[model samples]
Target: MSVIEEERVRGGVFKDINPEDEDQQPTVIESLCMNCYENGSTRLLFTKIPFFKEIIISSFTCPHCNWTNTEIQSAGRIQEQGVLYTLQVKTKEDMNREVVKSDSASTRIPQLDFEIPAFTQKGSLSTIEGLLDRAVAGLEQDQPIRKATDPAVAEKIEEFIERLKKLKKVEEEFTLIIDDPSGNSFIENPSAPQKDTALTVTHYKRTPEHNAVLGIETEEEEDDRKPVNDLDTMRNEVLVFNTNCPECNAPANTNMKLVQIPHFKEVIIMATNCDSCRHRTNEVKSGGATEELGTRITLHLTDPSDMSRDLLKSETCSVLIPELEFELGMAALGGKFTTLEGLLKDIKDLIVSKNPFMCGDSSTADRAGKLELFGQKIDKIIAGEMDVHVILDDPAGNSYLQNVYAPDPDPEMKIEKYTRTFEQNEDLGLNDMKTEGYAEK
Candidate 1:
């Protein structure tokens, strides 16, 4: 058997059998070096994420032999050492009495390098087309849910459903954890190094076949979660963006996959997040145009196909928020999005407001009453002028993008447009232009 398989047999977390009882938690896996502390009982260790996800591996081994037996039981609580996580929030009404609280479990299921296939269940996500179909069907079918007319009645219904779902999900999650530490490689701190090199570094590699399978996944069907940063505040919202991992000074790339962001004045950008290292890398397009009209706002985004695919999905691409305009043939020249077909279709459904459209117009919610009426108008067009940005550079959405004529695709990008900013304080700035409005051709 291979070394990996051998370690799997001996020290693997997968082999851990949970004790049968209400009071017991899952066992922490460990292995002792025969040359070290082979005579002692293994101890149970627990970990928590704090102070930038540093690991504290502690165990009682024969100091002379340097052998470890007990599960490394260093009582690690993501150290609050120098962290000022808001002792309390001040309020007009003695708000200092109120404080925001966050609860993290000792077991957030350490990140693991599970094969992509592990998440490909009978449901969840399968193919790009299939997932989209499922989402569309989910929208079409009312999800077999019912509403209660009153608050009290609704509370009872929600409580019962929540209980059932919670129990079911927990049972499933327990069985799915093959290794206690899935992507957990080394505990961050300066723990004494092991005498033997048995403790392995686990990594996951996608086979050519798997890459092809993912390549076939509809790019639009991606649903990644993202955290918001409130630069205005200094609480837990102080998560670093485009920042490197505190442990290894290696570059940590981040991306945002927006879904259903209400408004740009103050908006929400949903995105897929990284499990290991808590990375936020995803695909992105860094350009667009901005046309401001008094109280009204306009946003245009360039297609992703015209940019480097590596930069688009890379964890390291810088964000450029004003290249809002797009011309055809950009993707053919290596742009942000892959192709026009899938990109446009996805954006259409989003701005059109159906089929799990993740990203939408920045001003979509500005004139709720007015835009509501205009949205009905876009539904009627098979190929009509869009009030929002619909950019792409690839032919993946559907091959039709292969023939669409997108001019100013790149060669025409004005250097001034690239540098223009409305205000230093603004989240983004673009060329201020004016369009009559969203009227058909």
Candidate 2:
């Protein structure tokens, strides 16, 4: 048998076995060394991280030249959107946070104005300190040659390298940002299952230019090649399309349907399920154009039956609870069509369970107590044991709370319409949009 086959057989890395299985062992294979032009050994391991995605780690060692290289690659499909992670490094403990830097990801330190552009270095699974060490090593590697060629430039680079090294000590605060168009990179959240206050993770729709760089076709490009179909005519009919699962990145089908509420307008609901990971997600979106005036819906929860009221919160809607002094901004939970109780439960889960510093060793007794108390208040409100006002503010005026009295206005419910502010219009990208005279321009 060949060396690769023999190694696979000996390591028990079989095709029938799941590559992402935790029990799987690394497989060794012979390869050519680029530096020495000699045979080398490459060890490849496929593993899945807990609460994360699958990845492949490969390390190559040259026996003749004593050269070694390591790399990591995501074993999942590219995400539909790009991800930007902003981390606040304030303490030395922050240096221990794990980071998965993809080859397509760019790293930036805002304080030093230092950036490592995408494709400049191979992808690696390392901690923050490890990344800084690698950067220092890389800079030092070429310093001798630079010093002989240009002394002045070498001195500046040496100073910069020192600054990079000092970041590990975290003597001063710095912001580390990772922008990945492929969205496969990740920074470990020590507060798993909770929101990390110091770490902000934002997933944005990839721009056309970003998609082009990633070799992904834009929606406009795909529309040009395919015939356009009227979605309005297919209302009530479930449309199925193929997409990658957000959780596992496996191939899956998304089902979409347009449903018109009795008094409200049309809305589209989309659902996706992945068989490989058994992950499921559903989202709701407004099907109509932006309204001329923004809408604000307020409901007073006094009776237990108020929890049964159906509510539709658009992606552009912000939620506010006066009693709890809690305010959730738009896009926090995406669009959801659920009952009052369901919505409150989701909010409670988001604030209580997803809080990074609420339950872990990094948490303090005082802070954890406050969050725990806040969660109990939400439960009381949901149980109708407490009287509170729930407000829904939608800049696009697409959100709605079902009126118990259909023909007549409910006494406890209030609906107000007002002109959207310039900032709100700007947030919705309406300020830059020209409805007319665009062709002349």
Candidate 3:
């Protein structure tokens, strides 16, 4: 497209940008209808959005087959990282703030435990309230929530949506968080806080798995992709066969894939879903070496920057925060790749989410108090108010904890790696079997 033509497309969205281009027509591309085999039945209308740089809105429709679709595509280079926008909706005024949600953005209301995953809707320019309204509409048409077999579950979903509607009217207060791995989402900022609540935006690196789902591949990402011929890769990359669902004995398919972590190694993340019973299982396995002894690494976390250190905890890794007397094994935290702060937060959230008292049992007062105290310590550690030792022990030799200020070593940081005990090896199931399938001794 020519510069003037680009201006014409953008002018349609931003009137002030090109007032003299009133005679311009939308560019159309003719193609075969996707739904039907008919020729020259599909029409695509392209327009440029001014808010997002070089982003074009493509609307497609086929009159013959009545198939319609709308998507947002980027005409510019790929963004190096994802974007996250967070707004605290405390007043009706805040609800009026404009929002530009890309198709790849996911919405989350942590208070409600509700999430609208990416690819659920097309890109839109709307107010905060409008976004919530769309979310309510989506829930109404959601097959799983609307047609839930359990009456209580369906009713709960309905009630939660009603609360979301209240948010639009400023009758309720909740935090709205949007995560766009594609980095195409946006939220308006008025230079200062509208009321007592301020908007917070964060940009973070997206995992390779997310990039794969978004169809984004760069040279670095391509280099991290697993080769098809590797046996370990095939275990997670190939669909072995279809089998009956273990839950309902209905036919089901199991899908798995090898997701490589940038600046790190690959991992096999397997997932299985049963359509009949809706049974699902997801597991992450490391594609690293297996050694005779376990590995242990420790770091004294004191600065705020320390929280941003990269962490790769294999499924067999155990974590410890010495100051808080907190220790979680592989069974507790499982395999995860996150920042130090994120890992600490996850520990706190897990405690609260699983605590009987917090969940409404209310009988374990003593335990609840202890949990609250521990959680406070975690918060302090993350805020850099408290110094603590962070440790990772992995028997599988597949885990990693980057040296403080890694790729640049920090002199003040302490990181120690050591071997594991025979007892620890036994716990990792590394005992019993020999190379010849018999006792070595």
Candidate 4:
């Protein structure tokens, strides 16, 4: 029998399994090391995870090359649909709550402009404060930040780190959002001081790419599966044939996949990395069909939770934030898939980038003063100290402002559908369709 089979049959590796759960035992699977291709050099340890049922913790290490990897996999036949866990962390006690985050989970703290992307680490079992600490450590260890020589940039990073530490200590309040497409992550509800009041858990459907990552294959689907980030998955099964880099005409690799917005329809996000020129570009395309009537959406950001709402803007959508004195025409921004606060920060960055002279360049003294004041107001709005209105106007009516629960409309939001003006039609190159009696010859 192979070593793995022996480990499965004679399970004595975890003799000290928690006394309360004596029946549980760890299984070891020995396989070839990925790094060195040495037989029996990789040992995968499988053990039952506490607090959650039908779940097993899997960790592997290669003695040959010191390679290590860990993952949380389900042992039972039943798998919950994708899930999102949102907790309003108010006090230091709230940060002490236990969290079981899967490797597939992506965490976001909107107010902090912080996100810990999926697959960045093997699953982590930590407290809310510990999670924030991980995010801080990641930022500090990031190559770009560590190697940056600009004093101003370094100062800003330090300030951001201090703010995050404050959040960890619960001196400031922010929403903690964890989205697990695999539905394997959880926040401890049993320890909540009040029944169902500390956190909100919502179940959602898994995307095709998500299911592929978890190896949840359906019998009806094709036997061959592509990687989750493959171009075929990004275009929703429509294969993109182009393989050459657009910038240098060199062979390049592309990864594209569809990601579902919480309160909106799915969007195809495509990214290409060029090895020749080291160029990278990302683009977003809507999954839904266009509408004849132009639509307008207005959202009131009166509460902190509103900042967490997802925003999807088509290329033809115009964005306006009156309080910040910001306006972007349809042609200004190509497209966007970001949260409300993220969108605002993007605009702030655009302003800074476009008007470099206004950032205390001394040559534009008056403009710098005005721009500085404008930037302060935007900062205030993002901090949730100032209430503002966000408006999205789409000539093609393809844009969307996320509702609280998708598919179920948000009655609190104001939406208006209007007839497209002549200019609007011209902008879309539809003026030829309006030439009264024109027909193909």
Residues 1-441, candidate 3, lDDT per residue (tens digit)? Answer: 666444443343322122256643446777776678664433333333333544555667777777876665544334556777788888787887767787788999888888988888887767788888888877777647456567777787788888887778877688899998877777765321111136665555688888888887644534575546767556455555576453333466776676776655777666678865477755567876576556777787668988898778777787877666566746545577678898888888766543323423232565566667778888899999997888887877777766644467666555444577787666555575465756677
Models ranked on lDDT: 2, 4, 3, 1
Poorest stretch of ten by lDDT in candidate 2: 8-17
TM-score of each: 0.18, 0.72, 0.41, 0.42
**Candidate 4 local lDDT, 317-365, one digit each (tens):** 8887776656665654467777888777776665544442332211255
| Prediction 3 global C-alpha lDDT | 0.67
Best-to-worst order by TM-score is 2, 4, 3, 1
Candidate 2 matches the true fold with a TM-score of 0.72
- Which runs in model 1 stand beyond 4 Å of their true positions? 1-282, 285-344, 348-374, 379-382, 385-441
> In candidate 3, what residue range of length 10 has the lowest lDDT sum?
188-197
Residue-level lDDT of model 2, residues 409-440, one tens digit each, is 89999999999999888778899888887685
- Distance from true position, residue 242, model 3, in Å? 47
What are the runs in model 2 whose C-alpha is more than 4 Å off?
A: 1-24, 32-43, 47-52, 59-70, 87-100, 124-130, 186-203, 218-233, 242-252, 273-279, 293-304, 318-329, 344-393, 405-427, 439-441
lDDT of 2: 0.81
Candidate 3: Cα lDDT at 212: 88
Count of residue pairs whose backbone atoms collide, per candidate = 47, 2, 0, 2
In candidate 1, what are the lDDT values of residues 244-286, reduced to their tens digit?
3332223454444332211122212223344333534223332
Q: Candidate 3 vs. truth: CA RMSD?
A: 17.9
